[model samples]
Target: MTDDQAYAGTAEGQGPVQIDEELARHLDNKRTELFEEFEIRDTFPDDVLIEAKNATQDPEADIEEELESGDRVDCRDLTTCTIDPVDAQDFDDAISIERLDDGRYHLWVHIADVTHYVHPGSEMWEEAVKRGNTVYLPAYTIHMLPPVLAETVCSLVPNEDRLAHTVEMKIDPETLSYEEIDIYKSVIHSDERLTYKQAEKRLDDETAELHDELTLVHELADKLHEQRKEDGSLVLNPARDRAHTIIEECMLKANKAVTHELQWVRGLEAMFRVHPQPTPQEWDKALREIQELDGVSIPGDAWDDPRKAVNATLEQAPGRQLNKIQWAVMKVMPRAKYMSDPFGGHHALNFEIYGHFTSPIRRLSDLVNHWIIYQNEGPEDHDLAELCDHASARQKAGETCERLYKQFLQEVGLDPHAVNARGLEVVEDEEDAELTEEEADTESAELDL
Candidate 1:
C-alpha cells in the first residue's frame, strides 16, 4: 500500500500522514536504515556521486574571453573589508561603504570572484555543478570549492586583492533602505575583518577598537533585516525552535543579502528557497479548528490574527491533531522557494529584485546566480536552462545525501535513556519488510488516495 493508505490504516484518512515528524522523516530514510555505514558505490549507482564529482572537477570555460578577470572588469580595491564568523576561513562576501553627494552611504556588496576560479565543464566546476554546492556537516564540510580557492584565493579575505562583482547601492540614512543600486565587476582592498559579535559590540558601544566601517555594516544589516521582516519574511529565533531553524535563519539572511545590485538592480531574480502561503483546504481546516475551540470566535480573516489566533490554537491542541493545523496555518502565508522571478520580484521580501549572493563559497547555485548576473550585463545568454537544471538536480542529490546522513546520525545517536524510559524502539517485522524498488512501486499503485 502507498504510505498514504498505510497511514490511513492507522489514523484518520487524511492523505499521506507523517507518523513521526522528528523521527519518521522522508521515505528514503528506509534505505539508510538498512546500511548505516553506507558506501555510495554499494547503495547507489556509480554515476551518482563520482560522475558529478569528476565531471566538473575542473572548469573548461575560457577565462580571458568569457570572464572579466584582468583589468577588464570593475576592480576597485575593497580588501580593507572582511566577513563571516569571527574566525571564518572562507570569505564569500565583503562590503564597501562610501559617502555620496547627498551625504548618503553608498554600500557595495563584493562577492567572491568565483567565476574566475570555477568555470563550466571544468573538473572543479563540474564537481561543484554536480555536487551542486557545499554541504555543511555538523563538524565538517563538503565544500563546493577546494581549500586552495574557497578558503584562500577567491575567499574575499581582508588585505587580499581579488576580482569581484560589486553591487553598489545608495542607502538613505533615514529609511536605511536602498535608493539606487549598481552591479559590476570590481577589485577590492579590505581594511579589516570583523565578526558578527565584534560588529555588534561596536554598534553597542563606541571606542571599542571596532572599525567605523564595521559598525556601519552592522547597522545597515539591521535596517535591511527590519525591512525584509516587515515584508512577511519570517526570521525565526533558532534558540526558540530547533537546529534546522538556525540554518533557515542564516540562509534567509544570505538570500536577502544576495539580492545585490548585480542580480536584482534591474529586474526580479528567482528565489531558490520559498514556502508559498497555505492552501484553501488548509485554511478552511484552521478556521474550523479555531471556531470549535472553547471561547474562540471564528476569525473573519485567518490572516488578521495569524500569530495570535493560529499559534494559540495550535498551542492549546498541541498534539498529533495539531500538526495538520500548523501546516494549514503555513498555507495562509505565501511560499518563498526556487522560482525564476521576472523582474527581480521577491514577493516575500517585498522587493522588486532578489538573488542568492551570499554563501557562494559553498553553494554552486549561488555560483550559477553569479553567472546569471554576469551574463545579463552583456553576455549573450545566462545559460540558465542547463545551470538551473544542474542546480535543481544537484540540490536534490545533496538533500538525499544529507537526509540519509542525518538518519544515520539519528539512529547512531539515539539516546538510550530516552529510548528505554520514553519507549522509543527500532523493531523490524514481516509487515514492515523492506520493499524492493518494483515491489514498492506495485504496492504504492495498489492503493488509491
Candidate 2:
C-alpha cells in the first residue's frame, strides 16, 4: 500500500477499515492476544467461567415466593425520586421530602430492600456475602446481584415500583439537625431519577421550576455538608486517584453522619473499616511542620481518641503537610474490617453509630445490614466472629480482583516499549531546581519502597 493507501481504501491501517481475514481472526479471538490487544472481554471456558462466578447465584425459591406474595403490600403512592450518577446501574438510594405543618421537614433516605430480594442463607445471599463488595472496574462492573436484582428488582427506577426500607429523619430547617428519626418498611415508585449534576443544575437555574422539596433537600444537605466541614472532617484532596467522582471519597463523604442510627451498636457486630491513628514518628514530623509553619504544636495523642484531632490540627495548621500528617496518623490506625462487636465508628464523623446502608446491591455490609435490620427486633448477638472472619476473607478477595484489574488497565494503557511499568515525568519548578536532568532521572528511577 502507498503512504495514503496504507490508512485508506479499506487496506492496511487506514481509515479505520484495517480489517482483513487474518486481522479479523485475531481480533475475534477471545482468549489470546486478540482480546488483550483489541480490548475485548475476558475469555474462559464455560465451566471455568461459572466457577469464577461461583459466588453469584439467585435467592432461594421460598424467599422469592414470599417477596412475590408481599408484592401486594405497596407503600404510599407519593412521588419518590432516585438520585445517582447518570451511568449508575445499582440504583440503591432514593429520597423523599415532606414539609411539616409547623415548619419542620422530614427527609427520607430510602435504600433498596435487598433483603427482600437476597434473603439470608439463600444462594444469592451466599454469593453476595462471599463477594463482600461489588467490583467497580472502569470498563465493567462485577455486580453482587444479577441485572434482575441490581438494575430491575432493587433499582428505584423512575416511575417503576420498587421495594425499599425508608429511614425518615425529622429535621429542623433552621438548625439543619435531625430532631427524631423513624425507619420503615415501604414500597415506592420513583417519580423521577435525577443525577447530581442535573439536580444541582436545576437548583442553580432560575428559569427551571425546581421542586420546593428538592430545593429544601439540597439546602439541608448543603447545610449538613457545611456543618461537617466546619467540624474538621477529614476532607480529602485526592493526589493519585481517579478524577471522576474521586468516588471513594465521594461515597464516604456523602454518607458521613447520614445514617448513624443504622450503624451496629451494643455488640451488634459489624465490619467497621477503621484506620488506626498515626505513629509517633509521623506525628513528630507533623508537629515539626506545624511548629515551623504556624508556630503551634498538635497533640499527637489526640489522634487515638474516638473523636479524631483532625479538627484541632485543621484549626491550628490546615496546610497540605498537616493534612498529610493527619492522613499518616489515619493510616496508622487499624483498617476497619468486618467485626461483630459494636465498636465506635469513624473518629471523623463523631457519631457513635454508623454503617454502610446506602449500596446494598453492591456491598456485603449493606446486605448484612439489611439482614440485621429485617430482624431488628430479634434477640441481640453483639459479636459475629465467624461472619466477620468470612467477610474479611471475601473483602480481601474483592480487593485482589480490583487491584489486578487496575494493573491490567495500566498494562494496556502504557506504551508498548514501557508496558511493564509506569512513572511520572516531573517538571520541577525553575526556582526550586536543584538537580540536573541526569540526577533527576536517576532519582526518579530509584524505587523508594
| Every candidate's lDDT | 0.49, 0.51
Q: What would the TM-score be for candidate 1 when compared with the true structure?
A: 0.59
**Candidate 2 Cα RMSD after full superposition onto the native fold (Å):** 11.7
Q: Pick the candidate with the highest lDDT.
A: 2
lDDT digits (tens) for residues 62-133 of candidate 1:
323334545445444432455344325587766666666887876777777687656655555655655566
lDDT of 1: 0.49
| Residues 29-75 of candidate 2: C-alpha lDDT, one tens digit per residue | 32234224423223223543353344234433433454577643355
**lDDT (Cα, 0-100) at 315 in candidate 2:** 53
Q: How far is candidate 1 from the true structure (C-alpha RMSD, Å)?
A: 13.3
TM-scores for all predictions: 0.59, 0.64
In terms of lDDT, the poorest run of 10 residues in model 1 is 440-449
